[model samples]
Target: MSDPNRPGHPEDQPPQGQPGLGPTPPPPPGQYGQYGQYGQYGQYGQPAQPPYGQPPYGGPGPLSQDEITWGSAAHWSALVAAFVALAFLGPLIVMLTKGTQSAYVRRQAVESLNFQLSILIYGIVSLALCLVLIGFLLLPIVGVVWLVFTILAAVRAGQGEEYHYPLTIRMVS
Candidate 1:
């Protein structure tokens, strides 16, 4: 009753309790499936390391106090710039320079720049509407909204939260 699929004699049957299955040995000590060795994998069930250039777990940590302060200043600077009629320049400068120092500053600066650019576009449209006298009303409203939201963004930045402006075109990433 030997199996042609098996090399041995008919008496060479699989051990009892292992019918149709020959005894298979376990992997050698310290060797794992494909990964090569045991220690090659961390403690059982532990997650593998992150790929190159990517941050681990929570990603980059929170900003330092100085970074927060500077980031907040970047947001507030837009408000000051508006008074001098150079709203976009403030955040653009902060974004180009201090941006490299802190992720917080970079984000705040970009957000502020986007908001200012949106405001400028709105202002242009409102001025065009002035031909029908609607610009006279819409212009003031736009100004008020810009002023209020810019202040709110500054406050949020001070509190360490990135404030997203409503109606902002987000021209900068």
Candidate 2:
């Protein structure tokens, strides 16, 4: 007999052992889609752990030597800004541009900018204090501290170590 409502005609049934009229069986345990085992698709299963020396999930890995060099340069560039009387602009630019590429560079740029901003505030306070003539003594001390700390930051950045500026207000994180 012929059944019009069925997928195949009554005379043309699906091959034996196949799900002719029954629900399809689940795939064998531990086996998934075409890729096979779990974690094959980065989904529907636990993700594979990163090998040793690799960055942890969502964290940046170690910077290369060239990245360290550029990061150090970002710290040192603040000296140019200081000489030009634009202490924050240079580091700000580096932080915005190169920061997207390397986390280390971004960190160095941000620290430099924060330190520069602090120096600017100190310079302004020193100028105001000049009315009492005590700023005359404090201004030189501030300048020396800025120069020395900036150089030390550059050295630390070149060594691929994180550096936070002392006496900085840390306006940027």
Candidate 3:
């Protein structure tokens, strides 16, 4: 089946920058594509050629599901694990599940889990220390600091950024 998001058949795509001679124009509106409504070019608009070495293919066609899965899971695992015990297990499972299965996903999930666990431990320590203070009002402030750390890490990871957790216990690679 022709991909609705894309156009024409895969075999018909001409090499980038080399539209085969006698190229056919995209179908006008009201014409039914095997997929759906045509966009800028039509059912099989021009091959989405991107500048060389710029993350390759454009418009979301280039990313494999595995890449997206890894990054997304890793970023969220950190934040989610903080609230849910099951989420705490996310990283451990990912580490054991074989990063080889999908290196990108495995890496992301493990890193996120590690970072979150660290933050959780730090919060506990901070709270205990706060109890020793006169007002003990400093406990919430410490929690907020760690929360900020988790938020920033998650946002960066979501954007495909790689960050290592400081002082994480390296139980798995």
Candidate 4:
């Protein structure tokens, strides 16, 4: 059943326009806030800006070129080595080893590098524990695990999302 509160339902809803006058005038540029500033509808139902310090469009502009860089997860994911050696561990290492000052870059770096590093660490740890399992067992596991995680990280990177590794040893700055 249709709810009365829902629009287009025959219920207590005010028809658009008919604000008691001619066609509603286009909201002035500042009607919703100043250029590059946000505004909201006022008493007469006009646009007004959001609170101060907020972007005029409601938030900061979309991602920039700097945000979409080579060191980004996208690039890391695409790299063959990332799929082979790092899987998740390579990107994690590279991300952590990044030297840039951009928070975005640093964040991505940390993630990609961390994931790769984790897999590497796990493989090493598992191999060293050969007494518990056969030596060759970890090889295929590492390969498949690396491939899956590498692609996952790469996909995230392509979307410009950051990747972080867990339980990593911060060897480099």
Candidate 5:
């Protein structure tokens, strides 16, 4: 019932005389089809390892979801600490802990720490300037900048992006 003139029809193809030029050979032994019995997983149900047999070197790998959350927390925690008049404490704590687990989190915490330290320094300088009447304006400006930057950093970290504060003195690597 097949049409003889149709292209790629079984009846229109050349005869399979040589095995090398013919259809693919059946899989050997216990393999089931192209993927075999284990499918994408390697033998014995274990995941397939990288071909190089070693994890990729240089730089921290992709940030996981947990890392991203912790990274954001590293920034937000600064705000919480600020209420207690210890702006550096939050990020410092986060850095000492979660920072060890993720480079991204470490970076966020370090940046926050540096920024908080800078703000503290600025506040001290502005308070000193208050004796000369210039600190009256500078002190409020510093407070506003601190609030704005802390929120900005937290939002950026939550979005899985990095943030750098302006006029910050980086004390930690």
Candidate 6:
């Protein structure tokens, strides 16, 4: 039982204007009070299904001409940064931005990113081998190969054709 001496106790006093009754009972199930029915908060308790004939939420839209241009640019970005040894940043930027809008651009960007990363790995390995004197011979070869493949990929992308670099590890697919 509730204590009568306790402050603000229900047993001590009935609700205002209803002296004979005790504390008011909660609204019955499925009954709405001040807010809507319980658990029906914002964006919740509502059907997640999209209307009929519409694509799913966040699904990739059709590839647009602008997206194709950006896809081509993604490959070219590698060359722009290749001078500074950060070729990955170019494709990465495209993938994070326009890539979200179209699957084609995303695929192109991912391919370039993987190739650049492979080049980085090869460069590092070649540098370590410099201690054995063989790296000195491999370094220039690696650079030339990287340049050629990058240009070829960029050209393919510009033509709206898919390009996959040879000898690239399938990382960040």
Residue-level lDDT of model 2, residues 1-173, one tens digit each, is 56667775754655444557643444555465444444444444454444457554436756799789878888888888778899788889888888888878888999899999999999899989999999999899999999999999999999999999889997888
Please rank every candidate by lDDT, starting with the best: 5, 6, 2, 1, 3, 4
lDDT of 4 by residue, 1-173 (tens): 76787766655545456744545555545545655333343444545645679754425555666566645643355355644644555444445554354556555666555555666777887788777776478767865766666666656665766654434556534
3 or 4: which has the higher lDDT? 3
What ranges in model 1 sit over 4 Å off?
1-58
Model 3 RMSD in angstroms: 16.0
The candidate, 5 or 6, that scores higher on lDDT is 5
Per-candidate TM equals 0.68, 0.67, 0.48, 0.46, 0.66, 0.63
The lDDT for every candidate, in the order shown, is 0.80, 0.81, 0.59, 0.57, 0.83, 0.82
| TM-score (C-alpha) between model 2 and the true structure | 0.67
- Candidate 5, residue 43: the lDDT equals 45
Q: What is the lDDT of residue 154 in candidate 3?
A: 63
Q: What's the CA error at residue 169 for candidate 3, in Å?
A: 5.0
Question: Which ranking of candidates, highest TM-score first?
Answer: 1, 2, 5, 6, 3, 4
Q: Cα lDDT for residue 77, model 1?
A: 88
Candidate 6 lDDT by residue in tens digits, 1-173: 66789987766666654467755444455444234443334333342344358655545455567877988888999999877879999999999998888778999999999999999999999999999999999999999999999999888888888899999998997
Q: Candidate 1, clashing residue pairs?
A: none
Off by over 4 Å in 2: 1-60
